[model samples]
Target: MNNQYILLPASPLFIAFSLIVAFVLNLMPWGQMVGVPDFVALALVFWNIHQPRKVGISVAFMMGLLMDVNEATLLGENALAYTLLSYFAIMIHRRVLWFPLRTQALHVLPLMLLAQAVQLVIQLLVTGKSPDWFYFSESVVSALLWPVVSVLLLAPQRRAVDRDENRPI
Candidate 1:
């Protein structure tokens, strides 16, 4: 059976809170573990798709700048990557919303890959050193996490229960 939910409008405070939380998660010292997903990218993509008006490229750029400062990389490396990610997510958000959660994950995979690719390219151009093959694994993990991210991010906006009676919502 199909169990679609009618989500309430997302709160701006909650959106900011979620993005901050994602940034904090990224700040955690994971010691460069391979396949460690970028929580900031995942959250950015989710919000960009779900609420394009609320979370746009400026937000992505700011977050990316924060990430660059935190990661000690060249400034604007992550800004460019995340700006492109938000742009791409916003571009196809309508079509993505038509798919099932699992299928949506498939669509998100490429966006994550694209963001990573942009950052990787910038890093290569600046440092002139190539990363290991495992560098791409982060996108795969982020893609695998799309469903979870969707559920968590949308939780605050989801209707608690469906009305079957006089509430024609």
Candidate 2:
């Protein structure tokens, strides 16, 4: 059995569960710390890449609205960033899935950076203030964490190592 070629269809329940978990992680206090990755954005990109039909722009928009409310920032700030993230992720999903996990991380880096840039631009326009340079580090850290996030999120979809000869998928 070739491990790379076989995977169970992702369960919708698990997908929702992962998104909820990512949202909870975002709600954690560490979010104020410099270089803290946006778990919700990471999860949004992951799901948009892996299950585009299941988690589309509407989901990203809603999640962004949730984040905006939680952070008390401008209401549409995250919504716009995440919507663009979902759009770009979906656009390149086919190409991205062909790469190894590490390479995929490289591909994801720009998307993360784009999202942060959008947020930063919005913040600057609205507040007339710039965040410290370290603000961009969140995207780099999130990209670095990509492979781990990919493994954990994909774990449930992977089949048992030993194949059952009697059963047909």
RMSD of 2: 2.4
* Per-residue C-alpha lDDT of model 1 across residues 1-169, encoded as one tens digit per residue: 4456678999999999999999999999999798889999999999999999999999999999999999999999999999999999999999999998899999999999999999888988889999997999999999998988898888777655665777644
C-alpha TM-scores of all predictions: 0.93, 0.93
lDDT of 2 by residue, 1-169 (tens): 4435567778999999999999999998884688889999999999999999999999999999999999999999999999999999999999999998999999999999999999999998999999887988999999999999999999888765567998543
* Candidate whose lDDT is highest: 2
Give the clash total for candidate 1. 0
Error of 1 at 116 (Å): 0.9
What's the lDDT for residue 137 in model 2? 95
